[model samples]
Target: MNILLTGGTGYIGSHTAVALGQSGHEVTLLDNLSNSDTAVIDRIAQIIGKRPSFVHGDVRDTALVRELIKVHSIDAVVHFAGLKAVGESVAHPVDYYANNVQGTVSLLQAMQAESVKSLIFSSSATVYGVPQYLPYDEDHPTRAINPYGRTKLHVEEILHDVAQSDASWRVACLRYFNPVGAHESGLIGESPRGIPNNLMPFIAQVAIGMRSELQVFGDDYPTPDGTGVRDYIHVMDLAEGHVAALDYLNGRPGWSAINLGTGQGYSVLEVMQAFERANGCAIPYAIAPRRSGDLAAYYASAEQAHKLLGWSAKRSLDEMCASTWRYYQTGV
Candidate 1:
């Protein structure tokens, strides 16, 4: 199948590109290179054995998206083009809505115009804001607290409504948890433009001596280590989940949201320890004030993903740390 991946050069998108390419699918990557680096394309080429067809464009360009679908004969779209920083989203709601929400609308319109329906949206676990229960299932209520999460939830709603309006549409919104680690080859990994927003990358930077020290966000949280706990999934595992979602939507014509995460939750300090053990180096740190709206502990229920898409995270925490260190040692 010919697949189009929006924002295909970014971290998760690049990994998913490799997964899809290895699964015998032709890939066309469309990215504006907003927060991503062009060198990622070469890394993906190294992993997939060739460079994918790339478009230097944005998803908001309806005409370009339509043309790509028509020209590439794109059978499915994995939408990953959007801003993801939570703090930045709070400060710039308009940009978030325009890029994340409105951009999706434009892509959908183009798909509808071309009569192409299969879509896999890159959603987030933040949509299930302030987890009411441990191990959030698909039935959990969605009350996204931040603008970035709201944009994802809003896009999910739009996809649902689109499927409701037409049974011919096959759509799946994959809500991802904390995706860390790098590819086993150490060719591609999370390389945020500036100060990383996520925990694993920040820890990686500090471990590699790129950064001075790691900031432990509030050691006073109600967890085993007195720090925040989270469900961290290996990025390669997350990439394979997308392939499974695509396969599950082959002949099915409906909308479903699935969680792509490991069912285990690890605390902040626990991850630091794991990385230290994996890399054989110390990651210096200091306890700092916790960010507001940060939850103490939350993860996903892998039952639904296994039951629905036949997918589950298969990498260990030690592997996640080891792979990340390998990628960093390459000076990527």
Candidate 2:
């Protein structure tokens, strides 16, 4: 299969590119390098033993996307391009909507023009918002708590509508849980531009002595450890899930949405402890008050994905931490 990936140089996208290449599919990476480094392309080539074709451009550039599709004869598209900082999104809602929602619109239009209809979209569990129920499934209501999440849910709806308008479209919205870990090669990993917004990357920074300490938010949560619990899926497993989704769409002729998660929840303290063990050091930290929109507990059922795409997360938390640590250690 010839797969064109938007934001393919970013963390999850880079990993997915490797997975796609290893699975006997040709990958063409499209990225503007806003939040990621171009060096990741070389690392990806090292991982797969074959360099992928790349186009440096924005997903919002419809003309560029259409040209890439026609020139490469793309068979499918894995759309991972978008701004995804929750707090940042709250501060800049317009920017969030324009990039996450409008960018998706442009990509879809280009796909339609080029007759490249197979698409795998990157959604988030945050679309569930506060979670009216625990263990969110595909059927969970989508009441997004933040602008970032709202953008994702909106795109999911748009994809559904497009598929409905044309039966030739095949779309899968993979609602991802908290994605952590790094490639075992450590050649490419999460590289936030400034202060990290997510936990695992913060832990990695602290472990590498680049930061002072970890700040555990709200230790008084309703969870067992008095901290918020979340489903942290390894980036590699998440990448594999994208490949499976593309394969599933390859055989099918309709659109669907699925959750990509391990169906397991781990609290913040538990993750800190695990990282401590992984890095051979105690991570200093202080318990801080809960932020405005933090959830007490959120995880995915993943049963639908297993049933539909025959995919489930296989990496344990220890593996997640260890692999992430390896990436930071190698400093590649």
| Model 2 lowest lDDT segment of ten | 323-332
The residue-by-residue lDDT of candidate 2 on 1-332, one tens digit each, is: 99999999998999999999999999999998999988889999999999999999999999999999999999999999999999999999999999999999999889989888899999999888888887999888889988999999999999999899988888999999999999888888887889999999899888889999899889888899899999999999999999899889985777788999999999999999998887786788988888988889999999999999899899999999998888888863
- After superposition, the stretches of candidate 1 with alpha carbons farther than 4 Å from their true spots are none
TM-score for all predictions?
A: 0.99, 0.98
Best by lDDT: 1
* Model 1 residue pairs with clashes: none
For each candidate, C-alpha RMSD in Å?
A: 0.7, 0.9
Per-candidate clashes come to: 0, 2
**What is the clash count of model 1?**
0
How high a TM-score does candidate 2 get?
0.98
Residue 285's C-alpha lDDT in candidate 2?
93
Model 1 lDDT tens row, 75-185: 999999999999999999999999999999999999999999999999999999998998999999999999999999999999999999999999999999999999999
